[model samples]
Target: MTTPTLYGYYRSSASWRVRIALAWKGIEYDLKPIDLVKLEQKTEEYRKLVPTQKVPAFVTKDGKILSQSQAIMEYLEEAYPERPMFPKGLYQKAEVREICQIIACDIHPIQNLGVLIRVAGSDLEKRAEWARTSITLGFKGLEGRLEACSEKYCVGNSITMADFFLASIVGNAKRWEVDMSEFPIITRINNTLSTLPEFQSADPFHQPDCPEELRKN
Candidate 1:
């Protein structure tokens, strides 16, 4: 079988979500870095692979292509079920997906690269403010939701798909300098989850394409 390939940018929260899932599943695949900063994803070549011109595109070993971080992660869960990313109970599964969508749909899009560029142009301060505002507001609701379901992880004691989204978004929140003190639940969960080998290995700072200056040894 051919090796599966993952096209993603190191700092992309969407890309980071898929990376964490792949790592947790112990999936072996090739990684192709798409430089979002330089508009690499918008190029004609990459566009053919993903018409949306987004990162975190996955090409399966059988040549099936999947886009959108949540969709790709769901596919991984079904295709490789040994290490489940979801809960077995119907309601529990829905709860996990709810947290993922809150981060992916309601929160992430407001501060992603494309939106940030369109809204703030080249103004770094504007971009940071835009991202910060979205994250701060999103975290308020997210923290409340977690207060009802969380234990050691976002949904329960076990690490599910929600933890992946939580860990990835918290990184973005810190990047924009969002105050973590206000959302103690989110901060606690993220701090606990970040230490796992899967999360650590899939971290943006450790990706091959991360800049030398930005890379963590």
Candidate 2:
């Protein structure tokens, strides 16, 4: 089968999640890079492919378009079913979703690039503060929950959907100078996740669109 295509920005956290999921599933894909910083995502061509013009629009091998990182991931889980992204128990499944949401909904939205860009014009410092504060607040709760459920990964001994979101948001936190020292559990989990080949391959720094200076060392 021909590889699927992923339209994404190198540094977008939401896009990052999809990349990691695809890599974890061992799915080969072509990347259609969109430079979010340069507003290239607003171009009419990209908008036609994705009305919202957001990065991380996935084109399946059969010529189907899929959007949204979480939705795309769920689709992958159902379509591929190997290297599953969720655990097997009733509460385990919900806990995985819950942790993913805590980062995606609470931590990611306010710190979104669009929101940060809008905030940048008025007060750059506030934008940075907002990103930092959002992560810290989200991590504060997430740290406690992980302590209860995690052994290695967020929901169990293996990776899950939550690990994808957690790892991506941690990258965001670092980019915005969010203090991560307090969230030891989160940092520890990230340390483990960061070393995995799939995560390493899907890292923002390793993306095709990534600048040479930012490429993994």
Q: What is the C-alpha lDDT of each candidate?
A: 0.94, 0.88
Q: Name the candidate that leads on TM-score.
A: 1
Local lDDT at 66 for model 2: 88
Off by over 4 Å in 2: none
Q: How far is candidate 2 from the true structure (C-alpha RMSD, Å)?
A: 1.4
Candidate 1 residues lying further than 4 Å off, grouped into runs, are: none
Error of 2 at 69 (Å): 0.3
Q: Give per-residue CA lDDT, model 1, range 19-138, as digits (tens).
A: 999999999999999999899998999898899999899998899999999999999998899899998889999999999999998899998878898999999999999999999999
With candidate 2 superimposed using the best TM-score fit, by how many Å does residue 154's alpha carbon deviate from the native? 0.4
TM-score of each: 0.98, 0.94
Q: Residues 1-217, candidate 2, lDDT per residue (tens digit)?
A: 5779999998999999999999999998889988988889898988898998787899988889988889889999998999999999999999999998888787888888778777776687888887788778888988998999998889889799999999999999898887788888899999999999988988899988999998975
RMSD of each: 0.7, 1.4
By summed lDDT, the worst window of 10 consecutive residues in model 1 runs over 108-117
